[model samples]
Target chain A: MKYTVIVKPKKAILDPQGKAIKKVAENYFGKDIGDIRVGKYFEIESSEPKETIEELANKILSNDVTEDYEVIES
Target chain B: MKVAIIRFLGTNCDYDCKYACDVLGIKSEFVWHEETSLKGFDCVILPGGFSYGDYLRSGVLAKFSPIMNAVREFANKGGYVMGICNGFQILTESRLLPGVLLKNNNLRFIHKDVYLKTEGSRCYFLKDSNKNLLKMPIAHGEGNYFCTKEQLEYLKDNDMIVLRYASEDGSVDEDANPNGSVFNIAGICNEKGNVFGLMPHPERAVGHLGIDGEEIWKSLLE
Candidate 1:
């Protein structure tokens, strides 16, 4: 099975990369830039079942401490 | 105090940590990743680097190393353990410290000197001194700390909040929070007060090399 792991920083945390991009945008396009946030996406193939993959996502794939992850079957 | 600095495959700060400890007059040893013992050191340090290539997650893969079992045992026996940068991630992954470190809120690697406010006088690693703040350098892409609301409340209630990011002017109020950490936390101690994980590189600050590094080392040694 193929799994797509979408990992994102929990809300209330700053996204420094996103901010840097925003700064770059402002530098090029001039101020008036708006909000920005960033996240990561990963694709993996596993022989494990969906339930097992979900558990893996929680236990090791994604950090529940500061990130929330969702799994989509491909 | 005798110190053991764990050396995982990709750890780059073991030597630096050892040098800092050596400067402080502490005997230091490097324990390999597969080692199952801490070798009688009173303190163990997990230094920073791209451990396990930061592959599965920063420090997540390293958490399962054989040496970590020994680390867990050491912490259980009231030994002092510290994690810096990648080390901090390892501690969180091992469940030795509360909260997990996520990618920097801005999503880029940050390397700079920042002010840190000491939360209280209870952490063994920080000594029981009543100092109010510390200035140190932090370099990492994944240093944003996260925990449950109840965990935050518990840390506050027990004074486990060790260090907080401060403004450039060294004021530690809401506006001074740099990484948007919950309660502006920069570091924290375990309930036993023995395990400490901080995002900043105190080793980098422990000399004339940068801001009051020598004093920070002296304070830790005290």
Candidate 2:
């Protein structure tokens, strides 16, 4: 099975890289987007069960204090 | 005390740490990250560098190294463990320390000397200073420390905040914060005060310009 996980900084936390990207995009978009939040995507392939993959994603793939994660596809 | 500075695949600060220890009159050794045992060492140091190419995130991949288990065990036994720069990131990922290093507020790598003010505690890695103010160099991109407000409060209430960014005259304020770290924190210790992590490279500032990093190693004997 392959799991696609999306992780992003917690909403309350500051995302400098995301902000920088947003600034650049604005120069080209002409203020089409409101706020830009940057995040990372991970795809993990494993033969293990869903529970195991979920556990792995929770433990190693994301840090709860600063980032949030979700299993987008499995 | 014998210090074992663990060198991960991309660790570049191992020699600098070793040299700093030598300057403090202590013999140190560089141990590869694959070792499973840290039995005889009194202190373990994870030096700065682009460990594991800083792939997924700074310090993320390196935290899973085989040597980290031994480092954790050593820290659990009350042995001193210090992590600098990328090492600090690894420690936080391993959950040895709280919080995470976010991208710099300016979204750029900062490599310059800044003043550090030690909080009013006599930590093992601290305590031999002139009013606890010293100049140290910080070189990293993802060094903006982030944590929950409650966690920040807890760290402050417990004196876990070891060092913070400060002005040249040792005044800590918003203007002195180089990386937007909460509470201007540049370094912190675990609740037990055994494990330590800092974003600045004390080893890099040891032998040159003002020579403040030596006081940290010299405090090991105190």
Q: Could you report the Cα RMSD, in angstroms, for every candidate shown? A: 3.6, 1.5
- CA lDDT scores, all candidates in order: 0.81, 0.86
Q: State how far residue B100 of model 1 sits from its true place (Å).
A: 2.2
Candidate 2 per-residue lDDT, tens place, B48-130, comes to 99998988778988888899989888888888999999989999999999999988999889999999998965356885655
Per-residue lDDT of model 2, residues A36-69, tens digit only: 8888898888787778867877888888888888
The residue pairs found clashing in candidate 2 are none
| Alpha-carbon shift of residue B35 in model 1 (angstroms) | 1.5
| Model 1 residue-pair collision total | 9
Interface RMSD of each: 2.5, 1.1
Q: Give one clash count per candidate, in the order shown.
A: 9, 0
Lowest summed lDDT window (length 10), candidate 2 chain B = B121-130
Over 4 Å off, model 1: A1-44, A71-74, B128-130, B167-170, B210-222
What is the alpha-carbon lDDT of model 1 when measured against the actual structure?
0.81
CA lDDT of B53 in candidate 1? 95
